[model samples]
Target chain A: MIHLLKQQWWKYTAVIILLYVLIGGMLVPLGPSALSLYPVSIPSDTSVNFTITGYHTHFEDAKDLQVWFKPTTGTQFYKADSIVPIINSTVRIVFHMPKSNLANKHSENYDLVVNDSIDGTLTTVYAMTVAAGTGESSPAVTPANQPEVNQLKFKAFAFPFQKILFQTIRNTFFHVPMWFAMMFLLIFSLVYSILYLRTGKIEYDILASQAVATALLFGVLGLATGMMWATYTWGQPWPNDPKLNGAAIGVIIYLAYIVLRGSLSDEIQKAKISAVYNVFAIVIFTLFIFVIPRLKTVDSLHPGNGGNPAFGKYDMDNHLRMFFYPAVIGWALLGFWIMSVRVRIKLLQHKKSLL
Target chain B: MRKLLCFIIVIFTVLYTSAQSAEPIPSLMESNLKIYVVVGVLTIIFSGIIIFLLSMDRRLKKLEEGH
Candidate 1:
């Protein structure tokens, strides 16, 4: 065991460090409630009373609360002078919406930000849409001069800080990287498979098999992180979205590749047949992940479908792109490192077998 | 060998078909299904690769020993 550890120490060490970065370092800093959005909806031209509830787990102590509201498309947030001090574990703030502001056609929605001083928790500014009322009459009080149409810059909070440290956004880092790594490894596996078929060499077969094995590892990690992200974002452990279904089908095809490899007894024949099948599997997997998800008929809650924007103006930003792109490269490199080690091990064993 | 291959195919096909047929999911159910399938597929693929690698190692050992 020590000999084995020493021989593969670098690979093992790199994997351990990566795991630590994934779970202990990155995930812990990213809080559990990091990606949550509060829902708020109020009717226009009416006064409504609403309470803000904050659940406390770590610090049960009460804290000073400040609520901020700004127009969704504007910069200036109306800060409430009244600070609600929490008596019990839960803090509730009641606020009334002005009827006149609701009547103005200038604003359609408001962004709400709730802050706790003691715990230092800043809730994502929840956006509330204004519903039309029966009385469509203009506001009773009209300002003498309305600002120029273009100059009426309603400054709102600068776009929320680009990214959070939690596992909630782990999909962008972990899951996406896994898919990229898998794709990279699969490309090599396909090449090796084709070479094995052409040359009838066991070496190419071993390389192809090792590459698949490495790709599978990345695929699994991607899936696990995706599940975690979905649970927090979509409020469920699993969703039958088209993008998700395509992912499942893609994995199944690769798994079928493995099962095919296992069933063959003759080494030479197994290598030949599995190689052909793997090539087909890669094609099918690509179609499932890319082509199937793009079809407009398929209803999916994933971004980039069903009227949802792709990772365009909404999904990702510069900050996320910074860490995310590096993550892809790092993960792919790690996958290649593992594949090389496995291929070496296979070659050693094959040499011993021939002896 | 052929029989084992056929059996594995049969099991995988059954699973794939079952997953496909279980659809028309409600909004909440749809979200949950997406998570489950994505994670499930990935888990299967990863574990399957590890198992295949270990089996290959064993086969190499057997061949080495002239078994």
Candidate 2:
């Protein structure tokens, strides 16, 4: 097991995988999306002209342009009467609402969909609200005209253009992997601590300390990256968030572990006490990070906590998954490599002190 | 250390060519507007890794001198 730590192959593999993640995560462009629409609400049985702003859409170059409003509740699509391209990223769409459009439902919000050959399909949810009309007729439901944009000739491999996230979505490859790597390293150290308690070997103690130290580095990096991303997207470097506070607490707990080690003079006593403390610290750390933030009463802005969908289910598609999984493995391997080096150094120092 | 540098350079060269080939007309203006945020993020992570490695190197050097 110790020999595996000194192996050169996994270190090279870690470097290679990380390079791939950095290149692929950064360089890929974002997919086309409808950014916004002017004058969101419209009464039924009236013509409304909407000016839609798009991101990364080629409206000027598109020969086949189709625009429509899809209701959240119904399958009936309200197709645009006239579509005019104002610029490459802007379009003017006119939609005629049928008489008594709100007979079935008193209120409905329409999702705006713009489809073209070049950029494929772009949609903005809840772009327009249709209220009850004065007309005394039944709601006319138009049949769906599924556009032939499905057979797209060119589709770029790109990240999903999330509304607030934008380019900061690339931080997923870096920031998320840090926490994951930290988790793996801390778990590894926990196991080593257990082994040390069972067998009373100083090597196990050395491994545990080195792994915790490496995990602490990763934890600090995670906090820094998260702060930067939060500053840009959430408009605050540190929000009053449960998950953030939990992470801070977890870091402090590990820091106390380090302090405890530094103060102790006797090697065996230090090892014994610290190993026992490691078991206790990890349990509390796990509870703070994984359990507390996810509690029903605790509201957290971080995803996968407090009723929010995790990146895996909603934001991350196959394109992101391809790189994200490998990134986790790469960062974890790199953390292990660093920890192994520290373990070797500690062992060498121990031997020298004995001599 | 020299081998590692060589490996990184080779990978980056390949990445550059592939990126250019993938998108013929790279949208510089749009990328410049927001891509710098990603650049900043990468910088922070890379610097953190570099500093950690450098500190380890210093520790090793001190140990070697003692020996």
lDDT of each: 0.61, 0.84
- Predicted structure 2, TM vs. truth: 0.80
What's the distance in Å from true for residue A278, model 1?
1.2
Q: How far in Å is the alpha carbon of B65 misplaced in model 1? A: 8.9
Cα distance off (Å), candidate 1, residue A45: 11
Model 1, C-alpha of A74: deviation from truth (Å): 12
In the order shown, the candidates' Cα RMSDs to the true structure are 9.5, 7.7
True-contact fraction in model 2 equals 0.54
Candidate 1, which segments miss by more than 4 Å at Cα?
Answer: A1-167, A305-307, B1-67
Residue range with the least summed lDDT across 10 consecutive positions in model 1 chain A: A150-159
lDDT of 2 by residue, A198-272 (tens): 999999999999899899999989988888778777878899998899899999999999999999999999999
lDDT for A280 in candidate 2 is: 98
